[model samples]
Target: MHSKFKFFLFALTLYFPFTVWSHTPSDSISTEQDITPVLINAYFSQQPILGLTSSAQTINTRFLEAQQTTTLLPAVNTVAGVRMEERSPGSYRLAMRGSLIRSPFGIRNAKIYIDDLPLTDAGGNTYLNLLDPAGIHAIHIIKGPDGSLYGANSGGVINIQPEGFDVSQNQTSLLLSGGSFGLFQEQLSIQRKVDNNYNFSVDQSFTRSDGYRDNTKLHKKTLQTAHRWQYTPKNDLRFFALYSNLGYRTPGGLTRDQMEENPRMSRPAAGPNPSAKAQQAGIYNKTFYGGITHRAQLHPKLSHTVSIFGSNTDFENPFITNYEYRKENNLGLRTYFSYENIDHPQVKWQMQLGFEGQKGWYKIDNYDNEQGVSTDPQAKDNLDNIQHSFFYRAMINLYTRWTIEGSIGLNQSKIAYNHRFPEITNASGRINFGGIWMPRIATSYRVHKRLALRGSVSKGYSPPTIAEVRPSNQTINSELKAETGTNYEIGGRIETANRRLIVDLSMYHYQMDNGIVQQRNDRAEDYYRNAGEIKQQGIETSVWTYVLVPNRQRFIQALNVHSSASYNHYRFGNYEVAEQDFSGNKVTAVPDWVWTNTVLMSFPKQFGLNLSHNFTSAMPLNDENSVFSEKFHLLQAKGTWMWSLKNKRQLQIFAGIDNLLNERYSLGNDINAFGNRFFNPAPTRNYYGGMKIVL
Candidate 1:
């Protein structure tokens, strides 16, 4: 069984070489300060993950708001090869590592960013559920394909760090929440500094549900803002804006005998003209974004950064037959420059040179949902996309226990369709895709002083998004291309020496050559091809620990533990369709054990508690791995209490529970579904409670 779970995670990291001690030794910073906010937000200047060499993870939305879940799938699945899926409640899908076999939902071949602009567009979709997980305060994952310097993306790279540009001091807050099926939420936040070189922040939220099934309803609203300016100490500026409005409802997959007979049905009407809840099928969105950033230092070993962004979207769906409408717009720019040479302080070096560009335009339209009143006009298109990338990176540091890095990226993308429906005369078209080049090399070493060892070799490129070349079965394929890959990795990390146990491990192998699949056609429409090859290998692990009790009437004052695991072994190489050669099969929605665990406590007044568990295994819902999908175990719990009111104001309360072993599971399925509908049920025992107020 995966070599006895990789020899029990290598004998439990060689018998737990201690590591989890988040903070200690902060006598006002300056022991060469490096407070790991995922290594100071990795890239875009802040570095320090010791010898750094790839595979990243950083999440701290205050530990995902202690599970008062507002989705982001429980804080990005507690990171370990990452996977997040929420097939309903404003649908979201994310995968990195197994890459969701060309995601049939949102977020595809990942590459997202928030503070550093670009939320994956210009054809590489990513609507990260339109922000509002309380405006995320941090998340930085970069796993698998290091896309040379983050451009194309063969599933990896996500950086969201929003929450008013790092607040510190002036504050205001309010939050309320309710639970079970008819959940509700309201939130507000405000921050200000406005002086010592400007600062401001704002956040707004509203949420609604009634979900647990039956055309799963959901509603959302968000508004976010951040502003910061330093304008001097070598220059700085930052600004961001966001607005969102979303509407959901689309309970559409079922058949595992209608999810074992009504797991809250919705998706039944086959040869008829109704259902999808009689055509009230859902999805509606509205978005607007803005950005501006700049950082400078002219010379002090030279530095520079720049960003400018824009976005607009207005989408609508309605589906039982069709009623789609979109209107998107994009604009982007990113610039970079960096150069360093610590003048041989043991030989150090740094380099970065960058460019990024985007341009998008879409204006789809399709109609014919007779029940929801959208008569004829079967199609109307107008797409336009352009993406550009240029990247270079170099890092070197020897003597500080070795480190090396190299990177490269050069991409160019294109699209243009324009079929203004005149009854679609052969689908007017244009498609250009040619430039691609990606490369990477990494190294790290520093065995002991807490240990480290890393390695990497990378290359990946993805393309074919514009909703997978005009999807929704609207047909625009134009010989879909682009999906290259190569990756190899090795990893290690250890800790002890009084840090209480921390571990990380990695192993990877990836291969791809035109691997993009997503299909369905017995009139359930949706299509995508290429799957000539595919392969993936994996093993990932993570752990963190804590214990601490040392007296004080002991009502438990610490006891954390965190975990993550993955073991995939995907397949399908030299695949064939129609003529059916499924090569080595099994690679359909990956799963070969994925695990997560958590436990936390902390008491004595500010009380706290957390417990979690997750496990998944059975998978392969198609490509002849013959219908599989069912294997789950989940449990959750949360609790909190805080009330320190006297000037610095505070008052918190929280509660949670979810599927506490009431697992009927299928947090998202539909892999290669057509008729067998492939279940989507998920959500059984639920509960929630909340409160927050800080002024």
Candidate 2:
């Protein structure tokens, strides 16, 4: 660790030799300021940071475009108290101020949105990997539980906005990239505006790679289109459509001994069975989604927005034990109305009412796989899920400095399952999860122009997802229950008068009941069960500083430093299984400390360099807390140069390197595994280079 620190310090010293002795007039700052005004899309309204009472972060796409646009983990990791992990090339899981206990492969316990349309299905699953990074313009993350407005989520909220058409001119771009481990990617995008009222954009991307580990190959293709029309001054319409086909191999986990011996090996074969590699174990998914949103201004103080969305997914998985196929369909509608009295001089208030409804249907079939070929059908099942939620929010500002907001949401959900195998012994079941009410109250006080204080208390509730109740293990869990929790938080933000440094700090405590945890059986199959109460308390902080030396002789145009850290104290309360007292154990996968620091240097002529470092403490691997995963330190760097051509044409060349130290670590690990097989080794030192041409 000391050597690593010294290496980093030496790198910094080489770049900034006279940084400490440099001085510039405070008023002669660069035209491009780092700390600019920020506005947050708070459900129904746009609120400035000074008026916000909750913790939120926004990431601009420029940051993503500067590096490899292959995955979102790097860009999202800049945020405090957030973790995004890619187990393999195309498999990802994320958590925000929570454990990855319930997320085995995909996004769970979080609500995701693309503009005003919901991306999470009724079964509480989000296919975030379906969209390419190049198509996204911005991302907004609301940390902590926000069920009062988002509905039926215990973790957080994420809103993704896609690229929009440029009104000035028609544009086309092509990007090509290749890297180590046979990584290659191609992307094309077109943007055009027909007139003052209509605009459209289309993007397509393809990525393929032979991963660092055996049976970890990946292939993905995505196409997305977005259009907007302003029929009249008071009415507008927007549409989004997407299609994606993805296939990735899963190199199952390995025991510690196996990992140490050969980290690149795939899972070994069981008795009288083929290995994962020989069986071609992997996942194949094809999905299509479309949504339309309409906005109308009814009156001066009233407005309405409505959206309709639908999706279809065909999924197939070839595991060592069996081959599973699923056909899933989902449809949903979201509508909201807002009324505000902003004309008032002394007192201003706003009220919003909204409702969301969704339904999902799934047809699943399992078949025996004999050396990568399906032999005979083993089981068949049909599942249906429905969810409805209504929410109301009211916000008021007193004296233009004190802001208070309150919200309530009522949610209802139900599930039905039909077992179609064993003709004579067919069985069916239905469960209704009644109504759950979630409420929240938040307040913020603007102490001064450069300082603010905020506090919030909210309740979170999440029902069991379809996969949790009926997992791939071919077992139906009829006794699984919902998880509920309460969160209390207080935070503040401060900025220097010169607008060069900004800091944000927050502390939160959450207590949850009926928390769900995943466990593996003797056959390496996954299942879920309630793990009793748990408590999580933590502090999150972020700091940003910008330094500029305006002299023309200096090579550095601007230097920006952004850092974030989190400290967590998570523990289990009343957790016990099979008469064993597992109380007071540390929560699995919840690291004690996580920190990230990024340094960006801007030079002349659109040339820039970025260096980033991340550190994560050791974390428990299971409920027993007897075993733990090793801590890891990662270093990454990227450089980009842009050139301008005649007739509004441009070209950009970029290169990046990851895992500079080539540390041996597991990027993603199976949390609780049978026979203590949990390690999934990540790639060692790798490099990528790419170029983009615009016409």
Write candidate 1's Cα lDDT for 1-695 as tens digits. 25565355434433432222121111111222122323647755657554568778777666777676577787688788888888888799888887575776587777888978988888788889888877787787878776667788876788888877767668888889899999999989888887788887899999999798898899999888888888798998999988899999887888888788879888879875467988888888998989899988899899888899979999889887898999999998988899988987888988899998899999989889876678888888889999888999988888888888888888889998888885646666679888888988889898876788999888888888888888887878889898888988999877666546667798999898888889888767688988877988989988776655323356776665778888989898988877879899888988988887766665666667676667778988788888888887566778777777888777788878886656687877887887888888988878988888788
Cα error, residue 161 of model 2, in Å, equals 0.8
TM-score of each: 0.34, 0.95
Instruction: Give the 10-residue window scoring lowest on summed lDDT in candidate 2.
Output: 18-27
Superposed on all Cα atoms, the candidates' RMSDs to the truth, in angstroms, are 24.2, 3.6
lDDT of 1 at 316: 88
Query: What TM-score does model 2 achieve against the real structure?
Result: 0.95
What tens-digit string does per-residue lDDT give for candidate 2 at 1-695? 35776487546534432111111111122664546666666667566765588888777666666456799888788789889888889998888888888886588788899989999998888888898998987788888888888888987888888876333557788999999999999999888988898988999999999999999999999999999898999998999999999999999988889989998899998666578898899989999999999999999899999999999999989987889898999999999999989897778999999999999998888899876777899888888999999999999988888889999999998999999974535389897888999999999898987898999999988898888888878877879889899999999988877668778899999999999999988767789999999898999998777766233445887776778889999999999999888899999989999887777676776677777777789999888998898998777778877777898788878888888767789877898888788889999889999888888
> Which candidate should be chosen as best, given lDDT against the real structure?
2
- What is candidate 1's CA lDDT for residue 628? 88
Q: Point out where model 2 deviates above 4 Å.
A: 1-34, 165-169, 424-426, 549-553
